[model samples]
Target chain A: MLTIKNLHASIGGKEILKGIDLSIPAGQVHAIMGPNGSGKSTLSYILSDRAGYDVTEGSVTFKGRDLLSLNTEERAAAGVFLAMQYPVEIPGVSNMVFLKTALNAIRASRGQSPLDAMQTLKLLRGKASAIGLSEDMLKRAVNVGFSGGEKKRNEILQMAVLEPSLCILDETDSGLDIDALKIVADGVNALRSPERSMLVITHYQRLLDYIKPDAVHVLAYGKIRRSGGAELAHELEEKGYTDFVNEAA
Target chain B: MTLAAFITRSRREQEDWKYTDLEALLASTNKTFNLDTGFRRYDEDGDNRAYLLFLNGVWQSARSRFGSVPSCILMGDLESGYQLTLGEQTCLVAQPIEMVFETDSNAPAEIALKLSIDIGKNGRLTLLENHLPSNTITTIETDITLQSRAKFVHGKILASGTHLALHEVRVASGGYYNNFSLLRGGHPARNEINVTLEGEEAQAALNGIMLLRGSDHADTTTRITHQAPNCASRQVYKTVLDGKARGVFQGKITVAPHAQKSDGYQMSRALLLSDQAEMDARPELEIYADDVKCSHGSAIGALDEDAMFYLRARGLNETQARALLIESFVAETLDNVQVEAWRDIFRREIGEWAQ
Candidate 1:
């Protein structure tokens, strides 16, 4: 349900993503694997409407609507979610209040009635317990003093609460341990459905082992050098990106 | 001296007052020049049982629950104001007591009131003042004394007006003095607090917040002295400035030579919401004691861009995200308020200002 054609993105006159194109249908998971400086994160950030980047030439559409034109908040309202590589730590606003504000804003944009305080609390409690976030954790300032695993889980909690159609997991497995990886994977797996799609961006295949992707695109030197089925991830893992990175360069 | 004479004589070019323009403030207060027609309105203090009301510098006993004045307590009208005195070892904590003052907006005259409180040895008293923003020029000097082993908790909410509020407190041995104020800027307002710990084991905490916007100006100046051994003092002042608002904080802590083991700490932080918003902070520490711990810190900054982006990406608009960040920036300063009701009042006021 997402399309990208000849997307050339740059930050500060330095080209990061050059002539990249991809498409993902609904109910599918795609893993974008690339070594360092391969424009994997640049793609995710450009899709999520992050500032400070200029898309010199390209077109990106989500569900038949131009995604590049929408602001970050509008993109979020349009069912685009990005679980950032490093979740921001916001002191003073409780996690519960942040989630509630986000949910209500999205709902208001879609002509839905906002949930009352009690209703929001109930919904949060059920969702939090399912992903193993405690009531006390939800009461604290967002991500302040949280460990890496807890930050990822908190992101997952927001994803579940927001329930965006296009979820971009940007290096969600980088800082997580084995058990923490399982927990985050379970959370992502629980949200997988015919109507939801996830772009699991990572450097290693360890995460794809947990949340299996339907397609694997090997990105190197700002281009999608190869696109294949799930086994492509195994080949890249066995023989490191020694050839793809140099070959594409 | 006339208020005009005092304003003209004050050295606005001095190092401490360099950031604020007093001449401009004085010119803006042309309407409040009335010294003759004064105190024209009365404010309903809701339930007399909850507070002692002073409307336009006049005490309304009918609007005060202390019609049945407690034992060991004496209160009556002064020549132009009111006075309350508590006997030795008296306790005023059985009921929540708030002393509220509201100015007469119609007249907007120059009003000055003196609040003198004396807590005897082992006595306890808690007081709260929630004064609304005013149109008049007002001066309130709260002079308080705590005898040995006495305890006093004082909270204040000061807002817009050409106002000057001074809190002078003296704590004897083993006494506790806690003061917290939340202030919003007027054309020009100042809250100067001077606290002295005169005896051993005395403690004082001076914490306040200044939420200034527009061209409003507020100054928070404090001088805390530790004269006796084992005495401790803390000062935390936070300022949030928007528009061309100017906020100043000068916190000075002094430790005497004989006051060994004196502990003094001061921290000042300011958040500037616009390019024109300005903050001036100075932390002065004078230490003569060899065995003392005294430290100070100051930080002034604008809103966090990364945090703002994070909130906006989560679907909150610019206003909602800004309010959340500003609220958290000043929430820690309110923690020094020991009373929850007073804390809630400050919170409600801050929420309204954020909106």
Candidate 2:
């Protein structure tokens, strides 16, 4: 469902993702494990079309359409979702209001009528219940004063509500405890299905324990150095990215 | 002294009125228009307790609840302005009263209005003031005094035209006073607020929001005095200027020597939506009491670009994203309204202004 060829990206005149290539077909889940500054998050940002990231040489194709040509909102409406490493705390905009606006915006882009308040609330309640989010949490400002686990769960809830075709999880397990990790992993597991693709970017193998990936790639020094099965995560966990670092060097 | 003479002397003699130039307004009032135009029609939701209408600074009509004497609260008629005096120890809960000040001329004219409100001991009242003028200069002078343990809430909306408003407030022991203003700007407007905490343990809050566009200029000047021991005051003012509009906020809080344990906080924030728009803010605190706690802050900034990007990444268009953030910025002031309908009214006004 997604393809990247020779992806060379930079920010403020310094290259981050250098000659990187990856592909995830429909119904498959791929994982990218890398050390610090390996361009893992940069790849996700490039896919979502965030500003300030200059894609010098890259071709990202989503569902046979050139993804780089679309703006951030266009990419979102075209079913590309990026779960940010740190969710922005927006005061004054309630989570429910934000979700409703986002859902309606996506729906409008697809030529669908907007949902009323009641319908929107009902949909949000169902999705929130599945992820154990309370009505009070949904009524507060979006991610304002939320715990780390709650933010990740909210991201997942948004993913469920938008029902995107491709999902990019950027460091979803970074600050989570064991329990939060399992809960988040369970939420991701429940959302996995045919015709949907996921690119899980992480620095550790802890999250891969719950949300098993069909393929794993080691990204070091701004490029993918190895591609293998899920066992590669175990190997990296045992050896620590030392071998991968040396290979890149 | 005459209004024009007072303005001229203040402009020439004092630095307090530096930003307001009333020369044009005073010059245009030389031609008198017919005063036959009565009160302008207003759409009432029928949920309000009373409607006090004024046409060009004169009382036109006063409507109250059935069998309740409107004269008990509103005094005077077209010959003079009205004085609102609440009865002693009375609580009129959940009752919304509206006061309308509207003009009938499109030409630049000057009109003066005076209002005096007295809240008896332990009394409570809610007031909504609406200013609707088209191409006219209106000066409103109001004095409000709250007796011991009394409470008063004043909500105001300014839609169009030039407004020179002055408010003087006195709070007695254990009394509470709240004043909120939403300024939807087009012409030059200035609001001056002076609050005096006279008795022990009194509380006061002053809040304002200004939305400006099209070269409109709005200024807010406030001075709060803590005259008694243990008094507290809070001030939160926000301004949003777009399309070359300019906004200014000047506020000061003073704590007297005997006003020990007094607490005062003041914050003024502005959001500039256009590169050409400008905002000026000055928050000052003067304290003679060593034990008093006084804090003041002022911030002028453009919209948060990261916030804009966050909203857009959620699939909102650029305009929609900006409007949402702007609405959120003003919601901090609007959310303090205790009455649901009043809050809705302010929200609807902001929604329309955003569009």
Give the alpha carbon lDDT tens digit for every residue of B129-201 in model 2.
9886455667777889999999999899988666778889999999999999999873577788899999999
Worst lDDT window (10 residues) for model 1 chain B?
B34-43
User: Using alpha carbons, what is the TM-score of model 1?
Assistant: 0.93
Assess every candidate by TM-score.
Answer: 0.93, 0.92
lDDT of 1: 0.84
Q: What is the lDDT of residue B153 in candidate 2?
A: 90
What does DockQ give for each predicted structure?
Answer: 0.68, 0.61
Summarize candidate 1's per-residue lDDT along A73-94 as a digit string, tens digits: 8888899999989999887778
Error of 1 at A7 (Å): 1.6
